[model samples]
Target chain A: MTASSDIDALAAMILARELESALSKRADCGFQLLSSGQEAVAVGVAAALLAHDQLLCSGRSIAPALARGLDPGRVMAELIGRASGPCLGRGGRGHLSQPSAGFFGAHAVVAGNLSIAAGVALALQARRDRSIAVCMFGDGACGAGALHETMNIAALWQLPLLLVCDNNLYSVSTPRAAALAPQRLSDLAAPFGIEACTVDGMDVRVVREAAVELTDYVRNGGGPAFLECISRRYASHSTSARETRGQQELAADRELDPITRLENALLSEGALSAQTAQALREQVRAKVAAACAFADLSPLPVPEEAFADVV
Target chain B: MSSEPVRTRRVFFREAICRAVGETLDAEPNAIVMGQDVGAFGGSYKEFYGLFERFGPARVRDTPVAEAAMVGLGVGAAAAGLRTLVSITYMDFVLLALDPLVNYAAKARFKTGGQIRVPMVVKLTAGAKGQGVAHSQSLESWLMSVPGLRVVAPSNVADAYGLMRSALQADGPVVYVDHKRLFPTSGPLNASAHEVPFGLAAVSRPGRHATIVTHSYMVCVALAACDELAVSGIDCEVIDLRSLAPLDLATVCTSVSKTGALLTLEEGQVVCGIGAEIAYQAQARLGPVRVSRLGAMPAPVSSNPVLEAASLPDAGRVADAVRRLLMEG
Candidate 1:
């Protein structure tokens, strides 16, 4: 149980925030779904995963990919459609993947990766390797039939899968209450006899604790488990989508920002000094700049690349 | 020294499929089968008979009635290092699973830049046998248009065995479509293992007047029409298009060049159908050959015997279409 320290969590959050800021300034970043306010959930779940375990997520993958230990330069290159990326710029924005790094990849569809994660778990179980598959999706995916179907099958077959829902409470303008009838998103797993829990997503420690517990149960052949992290999204649904919330509401949401809260908590406890936090910010900014520089130097894929690897 | 004569045995279409899958399970340690009623029930068409008993529960799995999850599980497993075959009892039910099939399995290799390959087969049973509108459909044309999919249909027992073997060995996603009408029929199959490569059309019958191009059960219909037309001093050539995606236009052009007339027959619709593509491409290659197409009426197929017959093309309709094509040319 080598858990990530509080300082490490703060560094990961700062890196995600810096990456999101850098990506926003680029004109060629295309349609990105930034995980600006939801970094805690991504870092928390990634902290509990082993080297052999696989992690899958929805289109909002910048934070998750970075937290899962992928090379920052290659992830930047992939998002900007460069030939040097893991996917060679073929799976540009909504589909960035590098399975060798244990990040199985990101699929743009809402509930699309749920069953896929179960299948990966099935393969892992077959090998008897004790490695689990984790899928991170949004609140919008909870209403889909794919989730229910995957849950039923995963429970029936005892697949080692961890279903994490990063519930930001909005699906491009539709509130979670208006879209789903469940009192708690994790309650949906109850019907399938899956052990489930809800936690404060804005608190990195809380999210990490829940994730480690659930993943432990799954890795021990306890079948699939569900963990719902109630978080907030600071950005719009995507780069092309419009912001539907009011200014006051946005300000209130920002007050609960995971990065600021973690930094403030660490500062109050004297675990991190003001000068040290400022220096850490400068370090992350430099790292992000280096990643951007590497991506800029890489060339775009050739037009003929569209015909390659297509059976 | 002369080699011993090659031994062959006659087997039903269902038995041919069972042998191919059973052999694959025996050879490949990672291959598994998943679908509804595929375990103890031995598949709805009995095409998977003896597979569950032979492979047991771990390899031969019976899934709940969830098509989306079934396909997603297969695609995910394949991408993660397991080869899988998902059986959709009826082709119509495949619509529920297309999101995973078309979006995930089809584009996996290309999207991952060859980092991952999904060597999975989605076996679908097509055609009408009084099953009504939703259960009866020949949707091969819809799958053919997808960029990274390999669509194969087998009309006889040997092809059923050979094509399945090839599909199991393919590097990416392959849609294996079998017809309801072909299961009862039996044909000779070679004793040794064999594979029918994709993108090749077989010339079933040779003639000089006109050429009939079809696949699956429609090949039988086209052959019967050829027999009837021969009595009236008409000789028709029939070509079976085994693989629809990488269509073998060379074989079709060769047959059309000699006959100078062509009629495309299919059990599916004509608008944006297999015949339309075949006829257009054949004419483009050979330059100005007579062309006609015969297919099901543009209406929903019903369970009623008369309605089902009226909605689909029969031997008489194919014979008339061939006659009209030759007379007009």
Candidate 2:
């Protein structure tokens, strides 16, 4: 991968890690779904998108939102329910969105955003602006009827949409193998006539290459395409949920950490010195600290705000 | 010089809807219609008869029989800068698509801090027509309680056209309910462009003895009851509640104040139905007044003609309720 791409991916991973650390300590952070080990999927897919293209994701949105160029401070403000957030603190973490910045936002419902993303693609197609819509969902969403329905219509209409499945192998405590019957998640798109592929989601380089090729096909009017990124989640589903995996499995999963893998790869190639990696970490730490400070200074919305913007 | 006399053309309820939607498509370049049979088949009730031919396949598109995806796509497209009107063939089927309509479209603007607005209309055909339990329902009351949803029902051609026009132009999500039975009916339509504003009730027939407030096909039932009651030397006012969410309680209370009696009528269930809401609100505003609510029997609507007739409220039932309410002193 190019040096700039590698730096962007590393910065996103660091931001997610720092955000998770900061959010876990706050008492008023509310319920959060963190992307602890799945940073590569978000950053890599976001790298392939143009400024005009819109990206949508599931409830685990901190990584996707940050990777799609949302301000770290504003995201923090929204997460902490501050008035300065993009949604004026109304959306919180699950519904965080900034459509003007091409992040169509996240929907908490599983598989809920699939059809919505197709609709966004339909609108973009109507404009003839060649802007595509990409939706990132979990392996759990593959079992839903909405995904099938969306795929059928999307394929029939040839909407400019890219379906990215961030397969983290578990839905809460349930392992994907125990819950889903699919031999390979990418095979779900075969019947819909959509081009499909599976890749190593732990490596940002592999994820970005696959995303670029798939997005190119979609942008060139090749209809919809599906990419299954086999990744791992280092944390439980939500901050409040109990961990189902044992200590040994957790330790094994950490060995495949996307950040460590990339850092090691760059270090071996002499592309990133130990000094430079330390400097990047310090820079990311300061940025995250400033973001937290901004959120700490931001005020919460007044009680009357509950009734605002309601029709 | 003599001026030409103004003339108004009459049209079927479905044609009025067609004209209103056609006008919207003509005026707004981004407006589109999506639903089962909305394209070449011209909608289940032919409400979208000529839209496909006029707008072409691009704007007037037919979707699969998947109600969830249809509504979700419409909501998503609306939020992404396109005005869409999704048609669900039956109100009963709207349950399948409520996740998107109620959860996403209804809350998009409020949840997004007004940064995103879903300017879409979900047109559902409601009421019983011997279509059986699963296919027949009047679920407008269920949607009325949602905070950001605008619920409107049209009893005649004018309001059908007018409510749809307003719903399409509104900057939020609207549930535009049209009755299946009303599709065959016709009424006079003014040639010039006009729109009926929301939250306004039309006094279909004015009287001094009692007020019968209803909407959709029940408006016709109420008017028929008024006709029956008029012969008995009882003058009853008929108020058509065109919009259910932003209910025009002021007009209802005004009539209740003058008549000293109110009868809330609807074709849906009486328990927690439209009448229950209207009755409570009207009495809350006008103090204690003799009131009665008439609605469907507490049983499932059947396709059997006899059972269907026994399940829903009729003019006779409405008249009897009004009589009972008036006799209460």
Candidate 3:
């Protein structure tokens, strides 16, 4: 279990990095970023969740999809708005979702899917299905009204909802201190009677441990739980964002990069050798290149197709 | 007119909705009813009374006063294969949930290449009563303008029952608007297995002089105006448009062609109202000889009865518009 999880986590981090690199090199066509810095949390949460469990992701949280085992090629296709994309190019990178992959949909609105997660949780409970509904949003989403409403109802109904706030500290350009008053994002959950805690999002193992604990608690009728995973954004809000952040802050955040930390831990534990890690990196790079080529070769949707799915 | 014995019953507008929802809940195991005060409290308007007891909390659940979340919940739940019926207590509150309804639910399937289907029904009460602007405005035109959304505004109890059933059984998302004034008004209802498909106009009263096209509570206002015009030997036809989106322009154009005149009455604002589309269609379809549209003024509905009446399109306004259309001819 440990070996597979370690490999899976490493694979997710590599794919995310490759996706970021590929997207940055491509022309500003409308592709967004949900890569790097936050890969550990996405991979960690995806690792802990069951295959059938539903995931409602934020617009920028693409790493979860990679960890959930979605085809990187199809994801790239979706990002480019090709017909082969998950949403058939109807929704671009911001709205990547394939429910068969247990990814319900990635909402572009910050906290938009919170209520959706609550509703899905309600439906799961009604069906008497032991499977749970999980959602991940940024720290910026904590201030949205949907979050409070959803939390209140999830706790009130005792719905099996696991809300993970990937506290990347910055909501686009605004700092967490400027937006949120509470020191810890999970502290706000206390008023709703939701059991919440802050976890080290930089460590994949730590995130996995926290996710597994909370996931089990919710599945075992422990109701809703909120986990605030503290992380940082390696890139700007989007691929097109030109406003350079403070160099000092960026350097500070880069110091705790989850990918590097995971690599060292795995190397120290003798789970992965330097040569093997290099080979894995090459494999991921090749996969990313193939995915990009696949997306680039995919055809654009025909004009008539727009009128087909409105019903 | 069929050989089979027809079953008919008299029921209140609210009762028709309840019966339709109750029947849908009983039939579909995955069907659920949710919204603010929709469960044990029997809905804010008592439209869902006793449903919680019959269906249990799992099926008949009450939601918080979070309109955005409530509609979003319906979207997510519906996407998860549950046929959900979510009610917005007032049409005005739908503004809070426009993101999910318009951006999410309405466009979900289209974006997903028909891979994801959001089979949910959003039922909200619209129209002017004494509730003022926050609760009285008829925003069906706003929903009607959105593609990928089936907008239905039933005028009578029978259409309400039939349309509700159709909405529940629909393959995609539907926004069903019920006027606040029509709730207490009793009408003949047929609680059968039949469904009222979209884009069909029901001619309530047939006449040769002119045609009055309308829907929801305005249908009753048009009928009343038709009676007033009939007294002067100027018989007018009343076309009640049950569904707005897939607009039954065939029935409307047919009536307009026969009458050679058209008048549209609506409780919504005049700017970009449903009447505008009908007027444009009238010009393009039949090359209109005489046409007029009566809609609420471009202003909020006031709490004062007199001001509200003056701001809205009622029987008197419809009669006046019809008179002007006939006079112009």
Candidate 4:
């Protein structure tokens, strides 16, 4: 593995961990959403894309924002509903977007943003730009009719779009087995003749490798591609949920935590020493602390600006 | 009509709309047209029959039979800097795509604090034409209720051409509704480039006794009713509200104040429709004085033409509505 890839993976884990922890504390701030075990998938997708390429994400995927290099302080501010945030506090935590960073907001609606990403790709194709459009959605979004419609058009038009399905098993409280049929979500692409693959989402290196390969294929004139990452959620679906799934399931998923998996792999491969990993974790914790301070100092949006932007 | 060069050779309403779309696509490179059969097979109404042959598939795209995804794609494309025109084919089918149209496209700019703009036009065909319960309904009022959506309906051929250009040029999203019944109706087409701005009502006919407010195909019925009322000395002033969202209430108020009476005609349902809003606003502005509304009955329009006609307001029904309003005094 390249030195840059190792550092990027470590940094991504730290940022996701910090955001999850901080957001966990603010339980009273409406609903609590987290992308805990799906960090590797989001980070991998983000790392695969070029800087100019755009990312359309779902509300649960904050790792994409951090991986795209958005300011952690600004991310926190947006989450806490601060005026200094990317959306001026109008989007709150779920609908955060930084256009300059190529992170085009996290849509609260499932599969809705996925279709929009296809449009973004169409726009890029219209302009003859080499840049591609990447969209990240959960396993539940895979069953939507909108996704099927989008896949048809994306393949028929040969659009430059990469669809990443973060299959972390449950969508709110429903299990994938009960909701989706035919088991493999990647089969959704087969009817459209688009190339697809499934990867172990807990393995950051493997996810990144798949993302990079698929993104390259899409960036070229190879049309749209799909990458399904088999992930697991260590935490509950939301921050407020008291039930922590089944004990056996939780314990099994916890053992496959992407962050721990990456750290162990790095240490064993001599890519990162145990001491260095410890230092990196401490450094990220302190940085997140500073971001929390910045978020605290951020102001609320003035009431008078409420009616602005209606047009 | 008159020997005017500005009016194109008495072409049908569909031809006028096609001309306008062709002209806009010719002028703007970033503008794209997409719908279910907009490409390859042309449009459902033949509004874009020859566009694909002229502009190729790059600009004219044929999407899957997915209304929600189609609208979502338009919203995304518009925000990404391309002016998009997405067609819903039938207005009744817009129900399947309401989530994206009402939630995503309408709230995108506002929720993003104006950092993004969605300059898109959704071309929908409405009004009853024996297409059946699921296909034949007028839902312009539903779109009118949306905050960020601009709802415009053109009753005549000239307005159709002019309003489409204005919709494409507007800074925000526009829901341009066209009546399916008006597809074959031919009228004097103005060849000159013109634009009908939003929030302005067109006085299709002038009178002094009562003000008849309506839009879309109902404008024709309202005009016919005006002629009948003229014989009875009611002299109804027919005002066609071109844009519903940026409603031209000032014009309606001016006419209401002059006429001292108001009557609203619409093809949509009588309950909570555009006519109801006009009556409410008229009462609010000028204190209710013989105000009455005529619209389709509160039921699904049937596949049978006779049943559809009975449900919808016609010239005779509009005239009767006006007569009832006058008789109340």
Winning candidate number (lDDT): 1
Instruction: Please state the error at residue B189 of candidate 1 in Å.
Output: 0.6
Please estimate how well model 2 matches the true structure, expressed as its whole-model Cα lDDT. 0.93
Q: For candidate 4, write residues B1-329 as lDDT tens digits.
A: 56577556677788878888888899999999999899978888888889999999888988878898888888888888899999988998889888778888888887776777899999999988888898888888888988888999999888888899899998889999999888888888767777888888989998888889999998988988888888878888999999898899999999989988889889888788898899899889888678988888988899988888878889999899888887886
* Candidate 2 RMSD to the correct structure: 1.6
Query: How well is each residue in B33-89 modelled by candidate 1, as lDDT tens digits?
Result: 999999999998798998999989989999999999999999999999999999999
Q: 1 or 3: which has the higher DockQ?
A: 1
State candidate 3's DockQ: 0.72
Model 4 clash pairs? B6-B191
User: Model 1, residue B114: displacement in angstroms?
Assistant: 1.2
Question: Which residue segments of model 3 deviate by more than 4 Å?
Answer: B1-6
**For model 1 chain A, the run of ten residues with the poorest summed lDDT:** A1-10
- Steric clash pairs (candidate 1): none
Give the Cα error of residue B207 in candidate 3, in Å: 1.0
Q: Which candidate is the best by DockQ?
A: 2
For candidate 2, lDDT tens digit of each residue in B132-154?
99888898999999999999999
lDDT of all predictions: 0.93, 0.93, 0.87, 0.86
Question: Clash totals for all models, in order?
Answer: 0, 0, 0, 1
Candidate that beats the other on TM-score, 2 or 3, i.e. the better one? 2
Task: Encode model 1's per-residue lDDT on A1-311: one tens digit a residue.
Answer: 22238888889988988988999999887889999999999999998899999999999999999999888888899999999888998987878889999999899999999998888898898999899999999999999999999999999999999999999999989999999999999999999999999999999988999999999999999999999999999999999999999999999999998989988988898888999999989999999999999999999999999899998
